[model samples]
Target: MNRDGAAPTMKGGQFNTDPIAAPNEAATAALSQAEFELFAELGRPRAVEAGQVLFRRGELGTTMFIVASGAIDLDFGDDLVTKRLGPREFFGELGLLIGDHARSADAIVAGAGLLIELRHEEFQRLVDRNPGLVCHFLRRAIMRVVLNEQGLIRRLRRRNQDLEAALDSLYATTHQLNQTEELIRTDELTGLYNRRGLTLRLQESRAIGMPASLGLVLVDCDRFKQVNDDHGHLAGDRVLQAVASILRSVAGPEDVACRLGGDEFCLLVASSNAGDVMRFAEFIVATAQNLMLMPQSPPAMCPVSVGACMVDPRADWNDWYARADEALYQAKRKGGNRVHWQDAALEPV
Candidate 1:
């Protein structure tokens, strides 16, 4: 007797946990009606009461039971009954076939039932009288083992596929999250870093110890309000976009380009010295000077006043911003369209 009680031989001679042919079960263990009746004759009839414990799991089983009328419930002491044997069904035969076998599951009469119990002595007597019984039992027993193993393998494969799908879904979600976070820190208008992005860059720069020169460049479009009034706000917007383009082209991926709103834009560059900062500022000043707003409006020179400063490792981010602001103020005072760089380390651009 096993967890599924016993296997029944189906048409064409096959065995399964249940007698019915199932796509999931084994091939049929076919037997003639005469042979089945001869087998059934080996059992002795017994009346079982409803709630009667016929046999229990782990007991050294010596007898097999066949359900003649009513039903038999199979359990393993748990409330979830595993199987129910109805009319014309047989179970526990494996125990009788194999000498000194222990019952793998418990059998209880579901209701008042008519059962035929066949002991090992009766089974042996039948085998002696008709040796064909030995052949039938061996063939059906082997088929049961094969079919059960195949079922377990199929279940395991399905479980592995589910786990793989879960892992792929997790990876896709993580990638989407990364892209969303990148968008959150980006400016909608110019595709540049926003103020929040710039602040994060500053924090990263400050975290690094000395021997690093962090560069800051402030680019302000000179007389930007006059452009809006002259051509319209659209023109002013175009001017600002042009400035952002120039700054982006001059900065590397390691550098951060940001629009600080209004006519102010900033760049944070990873520089080895002050010269790198000055060269970047010069490129912005040169490119912006050649910008043409419209063909109708005489070449509108959108000159940008740039203020460049190198970070003092000992100084904080605010100190560097203040120095860059002062440099920008100097460039504005000296008439826009020029670079005012602090530190005599780099010549005025």
Candidate 2:
């Protein structure tokens, strides 16, 4: 019997000469009794022991084998299923048909038995003596080669599809993660950087030693609570959005406009000049005052106080915030709607 535990059968419904048979025997490369006996007479017999390797994959082969009384295993490797041939079954026909052909698999003996080894010369003699029978075996061998090629192509196609799907899934997951990170650091109402976003930006800039010199400007909507009380919170939100827009307009390309919280906004300017920071702060205040004079002014329009200061790289965010806030307090103390800025000199600890 073959590895499938089925009795080997002959072609054309003839009884297989082997004592054992193969179940569901469709078309095989096994030889009939007469063919085997004839080849046995022409070919040399090799006595093989279990675990003996007849030939390794990739070696140049010029011979074929017919299992006379034992089994042999063909290990194709690379996860391909191994095939076992029992008595009367033949393998490695390609080597005989195509001289110097590379062996595709390792042929190892599964048990101690005799194998009929046929070289190219012996195969030629058999073809001359019995052309019809040799032609049938050749056809079966060719069919097996075609079938194996088709099967390998199908498996490779499936693996390629699976790899593409995995790559697509990974791309989608990365896109979603990026969007989520943006949302976390963004202000929904003003579409500006939130507090966390501003802090992160500053940290990143420092890490890269960018923006050789920096400045911070803080702005506060004057009498914001009164604006919410006079109009509704909705109007107050619109007012804040308008202020954010003004800051955005005044900020440079490398600058960051952020709404820290509530009615407070800030700008991280990529400049060290106190005059530049003061000018930015003044521009914001003037813009807000101008907004109130517009025909379609914001509801319960109010002016905003501004503070400006150059940053000291050695200092932390808290120090920067405190210095800017103090200047803002000074502007507000002057009855709001104005700008105040500190000197570029570093403050003593």
Candidate 3:
């Protein structure tokens, strides 16, 4: 289309001699007055109406069109910008230059006017008659094709960059969400699974079907409140940390160690026998006893009482907890530093 958006003018079946002013006139390969006259004499003149389709994309074409009057629009699909040709502007030249060339854009009439159609034979005749003019047109056409291709490449690169940026942002958000969830499930002070974390882990384990054998051991630091009262809470914290370290040292890879609350801890171990659970509980008591006997021991370093039970897969968490807690109460009543074991039926073992 011309810069003014006006269709080419015609008078008495002929185009005016004025120079064609196209959009981006410097880049457009418009035919000069002499060239248009030459093509008009050599080519066939066909009258076209508005809304008429000259050729569609992918159609085999052997003819080129010179717009003698009005305008023709070339529609290149796939988000590419369209181009319009006014008088003296030509399209479909590749069809004559390259035999059986597929049309790249759909050529549709924008306004009714005369079009000069040049078939392969007529184009060859014109080429032989004036090789210089044909070469000049070919050079301009090549440059226009290069410029259009470069523009398309630029647009594609920008789209790729935008897509990559969106993916990066999504990944960052997902990573931050995972970190936040981990923090929520962890004990801030003890570096162990908090109560909520333990519950989640148990739920996950249950989802996969409970193992045939499991052991639950509950440990409580005897006189922990007295330690916090006599010595500062800081020392009590250190004692708790030391106990936690012992639990970590003895826990198997498959076992879960957790701090239920202040001075109260739990261990979930994989074991089928009541003896195995009892041994684990006894080990914790012995380890705490050794910590208290260490030279220059921290103040109020008391022993721990332990209660353990072989778990029944059919039983709920409350039943398991109640049995273990009862055993714990019995151990506390007997004396602070000791181990107690209960069978799956809640009978003392």
Candidate 4:
């Protein structure tokens, strides 16, 4: 796993022990056998018992440790994250030579662990005494830091790719889920809101606590089945698209327009007054009629009948919708192409 908390591997049992492969060895040459012997004199090898914590997370790390013969376990925490290190593999140099930063993980003895530790001050003194070695050691230190950073970078890049792929997969899955949801909520033939979508929208509109009023519109295509029977399903689809376009253009940004199966459509308007809704509905009716005057799409002429209901300050949304539906039925019954308003006395408008 990386810093992003992604687990790359299940087990925490990776260890490297070749002395030649130790990070920052380019500087190690300066510390000849004699100088290294000096370090041995200054510091001593320490042994830690199994399961014992050698260093803890968040504590200032000063000394650097090199595994001599045994292995050490690094724990991230109760998350059970651990990394193992064997002979010659070292850690803590990043914090030791730079500004004091807390240790990122806790190091514990895997079984019996033997480690050589070099205190910061003693190590610095040796570097200071051997100025020529300073340059080489600095280069080595930089390489180690770079390697650690690169490892982390590589891990992060991999994780990002994985997350991106996962997100795309999730999007595809959600799209399929949405199609399934639409099947449940939408009319198959007209691509309009079935009864389910209208109910959901009504419920959602009511759920929001707003001070403003709400508006509803119910629309029916004038002589829809006649066009379908005369021009065929393709022409019927064109008519639906034309009316849908008109509705989309006329409705407010916050408003929702949905096909309510067959030739009927509905609109939900929030935070608006009855007058605005009426004007919008009028626009829809007029625009749809104008479109019908154009060259008939293939073979059918399409026009729409619109009916609207506005919210009453004191009436329930259900009652308002019922009145709107009544008005729509009335528009169809009285005339094929016209607009009607809900009786304010019957509900909220």
Candidate 5:
């Protein structure tokens, strides 16, 4: 679109004399007064017919033309994508200023046109004499380069902001996933490891072949259902929590305790000997017996039966657990508050 008031002139025999039709005329006239006089002496107005080709792509040229009226279409490619220029717009100056280089784009008449042709040799001589005109063109080129730089900076800033947002979202999602994993592998009532967690750790222990011996201790709160019925489920939960605290206090750092279900719990002690397992079971029984006399109502006494067995790597986890469970039954049979140990060879004793 022609924002300025310049218009193209017809190509045929029509000629224009108006000076306002040329872009930057006032500046050019002031800078090239002597050359303007020379142009008036040597050159004449030229006319171009409608639909005529002004310049073809790749055509070697040494002159530039300024539109005096009408419009010309610029074609950069075969798809015919064209940009229309009108009214004082100039073209062919780039090739003219640079040597006999071929035109990069085709220029054709959109309508009948009038133009003022300036020979490159004369224009160069004029610019050499008038430094002001050369400075003005140079200033314009620098301004265009600065504007392009600003546009690129804006795009880069937007991309950086988007990347930061994406990273923040990913971090939040990972934190939530960790919390979910903890909940899934923990016992809600006793705050101890669940079966799944114990199994996983056991596999890792076996894989490493660390300490030679591992032991499982099975524990059952005596008459736990009676406690729940007499004192309500809340009191039973408090009792479980207290018992878990005591176990944690006694267990070694390498040991793990798991709540199997309801009132049953299990402990896995790494690298513990048969004597250590026996002593730990005895400690559990004595601790629970002492808690029985604490001034809590409803549940008659806090007491437990414990059974332990050394793990056999040659056997499956279930088989190891079953032996410990049978030993616990034997302890309960003997009395509700006692400790029992299973033979490492797992004979039916």
Candidate 6:
């Protein structure tokens, strides 16, 4: 753990300094200047800038380094800064001493700094000539190995559990967000897309390239007020729900079926063929007439009037809606149960 050369003093009965080991001298005199220079025999000077890659994870390494100044960081290619080595600290000790060792992580320069790289061959020469130094380093390396195997695994396991919990929380939050969005865009009464949803779709449509043809249908329930007046408001709600179901059944997946508030509903569809819009509108009119209402009110109760428009290529949502609304009134004027088609151009009629 003291790879940073941060030991306050060196001690142990096996190793002792002679005259300099005087009673007055402190026991913690770590690597005296002269003694430290011994590593020069193995040193090859290196300098690095911040963020520079010194070595990569899982690479085979035959060298170790001593940080003379600045700092080096070990990473597993994540934002987590795994280990940091300060001045005089050493890393790659395992790979250098253990023949054919592969790096467990990446090394990067954390700041501008210098280092002394010692290859395995130089270490062998040093150990051969200076047999006494072997015991001390070997003891340290063995102790480090024991600590890593035992401590590192326990630490990493706890970290993994913490990560799993964090991921679960993230998933839950995302699902809640989706549910909230669904509620915001849907009409509470009929479960159809609301006016807010339609506005958003319109804005998105405007941003795209012009379609071959877009169709809009405006539907109105005939004498809806009479139902509320003759029967209770509950009966009126049931009538609206029935209308919504009929529109839902008639619409395709790509079509937008919306309750535009009150007794009015709208459908927007896209088709490659210009004639498809008129045909779709006709089908909707026929289907609306046949819709069965509950508790059986008079035939006048749920009749519908439909106005449809094949939107012009150059027109926007406002223009299309106006034309469709005009057609809807024309249908109501002629008779309650009918479909009126808006032309490419809205004449003064």
TM-score winner among the candidates? 2
Over the full model, what C-alpha lDDT does candidate 5 score relative to the true structure? 0.69
Would you estimate the TM-scores of all the predictions? 0.61, 0.78, 0.71, 0.62, 0.60, 0.65
True lDDT of residue 48, candidate 1: 89
Instruction: Put down candidate 6 lDDT per residue, 190-217, tens digits, no spaces.
Output: 9999999888877776688656677888
lDDT of 2 at 242: 90
**Which runs in model 6 stand beyond 4 Å of their true positions?**
1-92, 99-119, 122-140, 149-163, 272-276, 292-301, 343-349
1-349: candidate 3 lDDT, tens digit per residue? 2212113357689866444345455245467665677789899999999999999999999998899999999998887778888888888877877768899899999999999998976777888877776665566566566666787789889888988998999999999999888888888777888899988988988999878988999999999988888878888998888878888988998898999999999998987876767778888998788878876545635789888987787788788889889889988998869877765544443
What is the TM-score ranking, best to worst?
A: 2, 3, 6, 4, 1, 5
Please list the residue runs of candidate 1 whose C-alpha ends up more than 4 Å from where it truly belongs after superposition: 1-137, 204-211, 293-301, 344-349
lDDT of 4 by residue, 24-120 (tens): 3443222333334444556669987788887789998778776666778887774344777765556676665774758878888887967778777
Where does candidate 5 stray beyond 4 Å?
A: 1-134, 203-211, 298-301, 344-349
**Residue clash pairs of candidate 4:** 193-259, 310-349
lDDT of 2 by residue, 17-114 (tens): 54233323313446667667767988999999999999999999899888998889999888777888888788777888987889989999998999
1-349: candidate 1 lDDT, tens digit per residue: 2222224546467533233333233233333343345556777889989999987888888787767788888875533337777765566766777756777678888878788777877766777866765555445556665665676578668778978999999999999998887777777777888888777766775677444667889989999988988888877877777788888898887788999878899998878767778889998898776664345463344778999988775787679789999999999999989999987766675
Ranking by lDDT: 2, 3, 1, 6, 5, 4
**TM-score for model 3?**
0.71
Instruction: Please list the Cα RMSD from the true structure of every candidate, rounded to 1 decimal place.
Output: 8.3, 5.0, 5.7, 8.8, 10.3, 7.3
Each prediction's Cα lDDT score?
A: 0.73, 0.80, 0.80, 0.67, 0.69, 0.72
How many clashing residue pairs appear in each of the predictions shown? 7, 7, 1, 2, 13, 1
Candidate 3 residue 221 C-alpha distance from true site, Å: 1.7
